[model samples]
Target: MLGYGGTSSPDDPTLEAFKYQKMLADRNVILSSCGIEIESGEKAHLVGHDFSAIFSSTIVFYYPQVALTCTLMSAPHSPPGRKMDLDVMEEITERELGFEFTAYRPFLLRDDSWQLIDAHKESLLQSCRGLTRNGSRTSCLRDA
Candidate 1:
């Protein structure tokens, strides 16, 4: 499953990205407290051959600045790296997107799927109050 964790510092744009990393680590620690198994790996030297594994998958603690647009107005604290690292991360994300798209397909309500809607209408209405407030936003909902 893909999970998204937002940082607590959205109100402070000036906060360093590493703070979010720390929050993720803290969350992992909490999970460990709840008996989840997690790897407590040591930091590898950026300039050494051992650091090559970072290219495989991005550790949550590390957000590559190259993933974002840079300009004269950009923040000055970005890590120094070859342009190649950004390219690697982009490729990885593109590959991951293939699975992400497929995972969402089963959740999508298709035009033909409206047949199931009327049968489930009462339960749907009772559970989804937002649907009443917003009305049916999709063609399937309106058609049903």
Candidate 2:
């Protein structure tokens, strides 16, 4: 299970205390319902541990055309790293979505390390145009 809680303003001790109290109450309900015994302040610690474990497994997929990003972490063998080179990912997107490929910049590291991948600009553009005309709803609706 995954959970999130936070104190919005750490600078204000009163506000932080109030937020922590609320979190404690909410966590108590969850723990009791789940039949779990957690000591005082342990709810926050458990939540933090669970959150970190889940976040480390997360994968983010970026779609430029729709200006959308999706995070997925449920699957095994997902990439693990701070960043990924998705230059060739545009090709995969084009093929899977039946869209044309357009211009795309390859991923470059700060130290000048580059992944050698051909970016097909024209194909990407065609795919984007097709997607625009059809819209994501109609095109990918069958797959869902």
lDDT of 2 by residue, 9-38 (tens): 344535543343454455457766876545
Candidate 1 structure, TM-score to reference: 0.22
| Model 1 lDDT, residue 106, Cα | 37
Q: After superposing candidate 1, which stretches have Cα over 4 Å from the reference?
A: 1-9, 17-20, 37-56, 60-144
Off by over 4 Å in 2: 1-77, 100-134, 137-144
lDDT by residue (tens digit), candidate 1, 1-144 = 011123342435455433545544664565468665345432222121222233212432254321222122211233335344444544564476432212222334374544665678776565455454443222213233
Work out the TM-score per prediction: 0.22, 0.23
Residue pairs with backbone atoms closer than 3 Å in model 2 (clashes): 99-127, 100-123, 100-124, 100-126, 100-127, 101-123, 101-124, 101-125, 102-124, 102-125
lDDT minimum window of 10 residues, candidate 2: 59-68
